[model samples]
Target: MVDYSILQKKYLVGTYVNRGLTFIAGEGVHLKDATGAAYLDLMSNYGVAIFGHGHPAVVERLTDQVRTLTTLHGSFANDRRAEAARRLTVRCGGGLARVFFSNSGSEANEAALKFAVLATGRRRFVACRRGYHGKTLGALSATDGRKFREAFEPLIWDVVFVPYGDIGALEAAVDDATAGFIVEPILGEGGIIVPETGYLKLASEICRARGALLLVDEVQTGAGRTGPFLASESEGIAYDILTLGKGLAGGIPFGATLVSRDVGERIPRSSHTSTFGGNPLAAAGVLAALDLLDEPMADHVRKVGAYFMAGLEAIGSGEIAAVRGRGLMIGVEVRSRRDDILKKLQDEKILAIPAAENVVRFLPPYVIRESHIDDALAKLAGILSGLSAGSPPPCAAS
Candidate 1:
């Protein structure tokens, strides 16, 4: 048989950091390799498989939808798609009345930006520096950072950048010409920086007063990843535009852009549409996901998340500069050699991901419990201890 990794490197674009590890299957929160070895999954496929891999409800729902109907164009109405949209809009609340489905988080943001432009009749926008929306041209325009934007110079939209978690900068950047201000609730890719309380409220008020739409990108913080169904919910601010993706469809590639009735009415027909958006299979998964991610699971997330974070904070290692995040979305800023520490975790079969430049981000499955936290914490402590003693991870020869 051909080596999957080799074939990928040979035939596919080399844009991702190939971990040189492949999994054949997943059950619950663990992924099994070809050799039948299981690795603890902490990152949940970059926060996509929030309910965990192959959950019975998600699988069963997708299977049923596949047998019945899978794809249908948006021009026609379908049962599953309609139910999914109705439930999503109700759950998202905050005066959002309509949903535009898409295939990924980038597509969701792309729709949000376009709707903002059409509703407000403005071209300029405000985005947080070091924030990540997506790589598509329109989404890329809102995503700040030279790393993601340097090659795609002279981005299509006019956007000004401001520091994340800074209300003063946000206020100064947004003006009458600003159509929208898009931001992540917890600043996920910006090192999981949890802005102080009242930041969202103040930003919402400023946007409304200035007549600029407040676009909340919950692509990472939504679906109970950060305690509530949306990190924006707790702030009690009615966002003009909201985007949801990364596991909203029970592992199906799905995205939804919700807008207030006022904004939705302004969005003229044929302005934006997607072929694969709201396919029956993905819609079924969304329904199943919504059913499973109920109030009890939300409570569980709050309990387990606090437990995990407390354990991480208790690890008194000088190498760890800080630990910050909400619910299952967590990050540890290390003093140095963050990648080396991540390698050490991977060497021990504990999977995680990176955020910003110095943060070791952990977007663990909500199914994680105290036992899992204990295991990861033990491994983390041991690795930090080894680093302090001038010993690195097994393969950290670099």
Candidate 2:
């Protein structure tokens, strides 16, 4: 039998941290590995599999498009592409009048930054500390954190960093020369931090008062991840720009940056174009995602997410420091040895990912039920107890 892992390590770039399991298939909420063992997927591949893996509707939509026409440049109008863009604009309807499609979250941020620069004719931006936009140069400039930006010193543009959730700091940061303020509705990579109530509304107001575009990066919280198409919708402020990706297209590589009519009009013709940005195949996935992302499904996410958090809080383990997040994008902050805890959970066949330094992040698919939550809680409780008892974590540190 071929050791695909070894082959991949030998040939592929060694950038990503491997978890030592090669999944062969996924169904519903479980990923089956090469050994035919199934593991409960709580991370949802960083929140991309909202309806879980290989959902029939998603597969059918993608399969149908694949068979018909897969690739058509943006110069030509494709049915799925047109429909996806139309629906996206309508769904993100607070002055978001148009859409620019891309192939990933990073590309979405890239387009948002460029459009902001074009619309306002300013090269300066304001971003929150600990926020992550993407690794691409344009996006990286707005992303805070020395680790992501230090190696690439002197980013694409000048960006000011302010404290996350601090309205006063934001007021001091935005000026007339600022093109836009790029921020996540909730900080995802920064340990699932939820801002104080009405924070986004106040931030939007500050941006507007200073003539800066409010660029909301909903790449992690959009597509109903936080119980709505866009998490910032709850603030009721008319956002000038918004970005979406990661499960926006039913597990397909897709992204969208929605802009207000004013901003869209300012963008020059043929300024930015991606070959596979809105191809029929990815568009089909977007339509399928929109179809499945309805009001009831959103309500389910809110309710079940509360239940999951409640379970975590009830565990009352000494190892747990806090549990925080909105909807399914949750995190359990541990006091110490975060990697050992993650490896222990992996040994128990329950999968989760890490964020920040000590946060165990869980971005489970929307298909998760109370049963799944209970199972995860049970395993986590056992793991925490074993650690508290000074038992060796089952494997080497991740």
Candidate 3:
């Protein structure tokens, strides 16, 4: 077994202060170390492994596609790309027919921002406070988190930030010069914050009224993660442009920006392109993942998420501030030491992620069962008890 800690320190970039674990492999709802100890994966690779690790459907399609055609430049149209586009449009519905494929959620958002620019011929975009879009320059400009964007002080020109769920603030920010209003239907990185009811519909209406495009960033919430093909459907919202990734291809690293036909036509050829985007392998993976999303998977997340959220609330633990989210994209805010609790869960053979601030995020795979939830809760309860007893866990030392 390789102690990756040493090698990681020497070669890997220190962008993330990573959790100290050397996970070797994974299966549905579980990851295994070199010693073959299983850990229930609540994180789901930060919402990428939607069907969980090594899902048969995603695996088979990915394998077959690699043998047939691993990749192709975006210069030519391919069969897989065409089929993938068709499937995505049918799933999204409402005239969102054109797709620009990319390698990740950030790239997808970047594409969407560019589309908004071309379609409106405007420079200004309005994004909500605490919303996360992506890390790229354009997407970063739309993202509201200061930690991610502070280093790159001057981002794209003429971006505005408003309080999420405040219709009046949205009304004030968007105007004639506004090209788009980008938002996450449910904020994932910003503590899994769900907007107030009717907020999305109202925002869409306002954007339309002002001749500005409404762009939804569903990077972490879309593709069955929120018990829907797209999370915006819950609000009956229709976006002029939509960005999706993080389990779009079930961990195979594919993202897409779906735009309205009119908006799509506004952008000229070769305006924006990626060498590795729209490859056959990724397209096949998305096709397979979408097929899986059509089954009991979506239902499973909705049902399980309700049960889990209720259980979290029932615990009534002093350490927990609140539990919020839809479907399986849950976030638990704690006043106590989050890193310590997260490490305790990890030690107990369950994995979770720390989100912005004191938020402990649970983005378990869509295929996660009741047993996994029970196990996670049990471990979490024990840690919470310890924290309440005024004992700091081991990870706090780190």
Candidate 4:
């Protein structure tokens, strides 16, 4: 048998920290490797496979759209695209009257940032430390990690970094020259850190008082990942701009920037455009995803997330520093050996991912049940117990 990993290393760009596992197929909340070994999915492809893999509804809709029209330029209005924009705007109603579609979360955020500058006529912006917007040049300007931005110094715009969840820091940062303040409802890649309640609301109020727009990056926390269509919705925030991606189009690549009428009117024609932004194929996937990601699925995520978090806390291992998250976006902060714990989980046929520095993050599909959580908790308990007993991970000795 050919070594797929070797081939991938030779052919693909070495950007990602590949985990040395190749998945060939996936069902509801589980993935199968080339060897037919089934592993329960917890990271959900970095929170994209919201309805799990190949959901019947998503498959059916995407297949039908594939058989019909797939791509059409924005110059010509397509039925699917129009319906998609309508449904999305109505669903995201916070005076969000328009949408600018793109192919990834980065592009969505880029559009939001550009619109903010256009609307407010200010290039200065405020973002939270450890907040991840995206990696594109414009979005990277607002993203706060030195690792991702140091080499690309002198980014597109001037952005001030403030502490996450700290309203005082945010209020002090925004002024007359600030275009907007971009933040995540829950800092997903920054270790699944959920801000204090009323944080977003207060931030919005501050931005409003300062005449700066509020942009919420919901790429990872939206589409039912955090028990609501958008996490900011729960906070009752009426942001001036909002960005969404990840699972908004099922497994298809998609992104959207929803804007309030005031902000939307300021974005002139041809200011931003993508050839394949609102293609019918992705729009069909969006409709199907919306249908499946209803209140029942969100309720399931909330219940399962609470249960999983409780189980992690009940492990009673000193190695676990804390467990934090909302809905299914959970993070288990460990005292040490975070990578080793992840490898151990992989050895046990469970898949997870890392966040921040020492967090074992879990973005399990909404379909995950208490039983699935139990399976992961069981493996985690064993690993923590072994570590507490001073026994090295089994794979480490090999």
The C-alpha lDDT values of all candidates are 0.92, 0.92, 0.88, 0.92
How far is 335's C-alpha from truth in model 2 (Å)?
A: 0.7
Worst 10 residues of 3 by lDDT: 389-398
Error of 3 at 42 (Å): 0.2
Please provide, for model 2 over 264-364, each residue's C-alpha lDDT reduced to its tens digit, 9 standing for 90 to 100: 99999899889999989999999999999999999999999999999999999989999998899999999999999999999999999999899999999
Candidate 3, residues 1-398, lDDT tens digits: the string is: 56787789779888877778888899788999888999899998899988889998888899899889978887777999899999898899867978999999999999988899999999899998888888889889988877898999899867999988899999999998999999988888888898888888999999999999999888898898889788788677666899888888767888899998889889999899898888899999888988898757788889999989988888889899999999998999998688988888888988899888899999998888887788788778888987787755558957
List candidate 4 segments past 4 Å from native: 391-398
Model 2 TM-score on a 0 to 1 scale: 0.97
Question: How close is each model in CA RMSD to the real structure?
Answer: 2.8, 3.1, 3.1, 2.9
The lDDT of model 3 is 0.88
Q: Write the per-residue lDDT of candidate 1 for residues 189-227, one digit (tens) a residue.
A: 889998888888899999999999999999999989988
Better of 3 and 4 by lDDT: 4
Q: Write the per-residue lDDT of candidate 4 for residues 68-92, one digit (tens) a residue.
A: 9999999899999999999999999
Distance from true position, residue 130, model 4, in Å? 0.3
lDDT of 4 at 87: 96
Structure candidate 4, residue pairs in collision = none
TM-score of each: 0.97, 0.97, 0.96, 0.97
